[model samples]
Target: MTRPSDHDHAPAPAALSADGGRADPAAPPGAPPGHPRRWAGLAVLSASLLLIVMDITILNVALPALSADLRPDSVQLLWIVDVYSLVVSGLLVTVAALGDRFGRRLMLVAGFAVFGVASAAVLLADGPGDVIAVRALLGVGGAMIMPSTLSMIRHLFTDPRERATALGVWAATAAVGSAIGPIVGGALLEHFSWQSAFLVNVPVMVVAIAAGLWLLPESRAARPGRWDAVGTVLSIAGMVALVYAIKHFGKEGFDDPGALVAALVAAVALPAFVVWCLRIPHPILEIRLFRRRAFSAGAVAALCTSLAVAAVLLLLAQWMQLVEGYGPLEAGVRLLPAAVGAVIASPAAPALAARIGARAVLSGGLVVSAAGYLVIAFGPRPLSYATVAVALLLVGAGMGSLAIASAVIMVGAPPEKSGSAAAVDETSYELGAALGVAVLGSVAAAAYRGDLPASWLAERGVTGATAAEARESIGNAMEIAAHAGTAGAELAARAQAAFTTSLEGASLAGGVLLLVAGVLVWVLAPRDLDVSGSSHH
Candidate 1:
């Protein structure tokens, strides 16, 4: 079987400009002059990306306040957090395919409208169920927005090098959004209600909807074949079931029959979905792209980086607030080292890759991140903020390589398959986050429990339900400590110590995972891979 060169996958003749105009005929072959408003349009897309990424972390900061107001049980609280990702991950391939069939611009605009409406609807949410519904709607909106940004970038920047730069900016925006989410949420919670966090998205989204329509061009697959309805269903069912199974396993381990059933569904449906895609002419996703070493390497880099960072970041946020006794805003500020490192490194990654090689940058970044995690696991002393800050900086700097990963994935694919490529890239991120939290979070939780055994709690006069609660989480233990007098102080100290120990254990595990992924990617990625050119060979 002869493989097609990247040149064979160039933008279709029908692709449009940023102003929804015809492509420039006078432009050079394989490197057309992009839309006049391309740079400005990138700003609009970056803003949208910022909000989408920020929403996840903002909820983390707002959870305590929301919990106080809604008084949701553990199950409901879990639903409120997990449902958004569930909906987003399940719908990504379907929505991205729709964008390619319809118009990327239309999908983006609609996503903005949906996001704004959902954010505003938070005002009416008076219960946990209402908030959960609102989150699901936001997930729908997020699903629409994420891939469109990447696909649109592929359209707007015809030059592979220029597109790489744009992707670097896009990656930076995502890093900033995640880094600042807690700060924004903390500020909102300080001045207003937990509802304010959701409400804040309304105005920005309204503006984004207006700007996106004006700035973004309408582009779609010039010859998108008939929709693969079966493929869509299988993809959705497989992803939803897979994510659900992971979440359930994390929460309940292998003892839960429901998790096992969900895992079974995912196992069957996913492989079947892959076969269905291969058999179809116009599959919902471009499954064949994985044949390219660069594309596969990029996907692996994104997944492993997200997996190594996500759960640790979430745990650190709690560590700052609960163990170190920092306020939300202060903790958010302290967390800035990671963001700062990313901001500095993201834009520089492409340039760095040019001097070295894409393979080195991508694999080296993961190696750096693994070092950061190892630092956290083996750093000096009783775990101070200074030690954590250094570790965060290293980790964030390492994440900058994702820009290279994105470029490799997008540039490696034909423009006609941009939507599919983007969907795959985003899916890696979403799945990685889900897996990180589930797998690494379980590790941390088990370690925490192991350190604070029920027997120890019982010996400390925290018998029955209180003892169980203490072992449940550091947060619950601290809450009990707030009112338990002398015993309370002892419990708080022990719980904090246990949490710190668990964080170390989880970090060590995550570090090992990252090291292994780095080695794999290093072996897989081509030594001479050039992200600026559309050639794998």
Candidate 2:
């Protein structure tokens, strides 16, 4: 099978124009000949996406340095880490709608400028509050950039086949960015301040802004009706509440009052938002798109894949750093198998889907990921790095199906609704990741605590506050063990074993979840679905 090259010179389908309507063959001289620089524009969009995705993970490596400099309390530290995601989730729908109403290129350029300015501003961040503010600003920029990239791609690549290949490159870039964030952050922090983790975005954004303006074409919804302020408010409230509640639940469990209240807000606001969108002629989001089986299946595939992978990847990173005593950079490099697998598989997924059905590729990817998780869960005792590497490779390969998911989603919607389609697609990813970390992370925490019971801790003179801290997480347990006398070695060893057990339990749960998701997607997605065309069926 020949792979589609970036220089695909296929003519646009005569039946479908750039706007997903019938083309006019009798057009007069100098009619819009479509963007000649579209492939170059895609490169700019991918670069923007890489930076935005990288920002999400790079902070993990910078947190220690930032915390030591600012000496923030626990709550402040959590905010520093989480505020970015919260802001991004909240603003995604609203920002995407604005991009459609205004121009996607304009939104994207402004986003680049904002991201650059915010990163440079980190130099003046002396307190936890200042850092949190910068992170929130960066989230705003990320929200503006994320959906624009997808919607712009829909406009740029009118040919479904070319769009699929472009999306494949987009997905591959995202995977690489996410995997390498920590490596980049670690490298920066070793030589410069923690601020360097952020400041690095400045130069890249500068170049992206220039390239984007030069290479990207301006596009927006042709018939964008009046703005829905109520929908905007509800969307912001619902997404923020939903994400905050999930994070709170992950940290404090389901019984926390704050989490419950946030969940209530999400439940109320999201339903109201949906109803409002259905009523409005020009809804902030095209909620009706979910009625399409292909679109819905694509969203489910994105959500479940992210749900199954996020927590496991996070835990593996922690396992490398905390249990194996690898430095941040070393741990990041060890985590690269998934990235390597994704990079190799993503670009090939579109071609594979073209040969096999889209449904097969999407559902099969999830099955492959399930196998990866099951390998970790049921692999031999005392799992080695080699086993983990193999599992990561499988999971990464499975992630390549996301390119098909994106294609199905974009092609399923009309060109005018691309912003909404992009927003929904990205929302699935954000919400799925939050759900994964909350649910599976909680399961892991429970398993860890169950293994290190209070009674068992007391028997080892690790009672009261110290025992509670040990029960909380392996990181805390290791810290306590470091200060303990001779018994510290035994305690550390037991904690490590317990953490390993918890990881296995979580892997089992994630594996089962992925298997269920795979079956559901297979059932939901049409057997004859062709992603290389605009028609859903």
**Winning model by TM-score:** 1
lDDT of each: 0.78, 0.76
State the lDDT of candidate 1 residue by residue for 211-240, as single tens digits: 998988899988766777898899888877
Q: Give the TM-score of candidate 2.
A: 0.84
What's the C-alpha lDDT at position 157 in model 1? 74
Off by over 4 Å in 2: 1-31, 34-40, 60-83, 120-133, 153-168, 189-195, 210-220, 250-254, 414-416, 454-469
TM-score of each: 0.88, 0.84
- Model 2, global lDDT: 0.76
Q: What shift in Å separates residue 355 of candidate 1 from its native position after superposition?
A: 2.3
Q: Write the per-residue lDDT of candidate 2 for residues 1-537, one digit (tens) a residue.
A: 001112222222221113323333443345444477888898999988888878866776665557546765434544675566567766777887788789999999999999999999999988989998998899889888887887788678765445545655676678878788879876777789888989999999999999998999899988666777898899878877876676567556789999999999999999999999999887877899988888788888888887777678767866776678777677778878887777777767767777887889999999998888999999987977888899988888888655567667765666656657767777777666656766687777778888888898788888988888777767677777888888799888888989888888999999999999899888888888776553654
Model 1 local distance difference test score: 0.78
Which sections of candidate 1 miss by over 4 Å?
Answer: 1-37, 67-80, 124-130, 156-168, 411-418
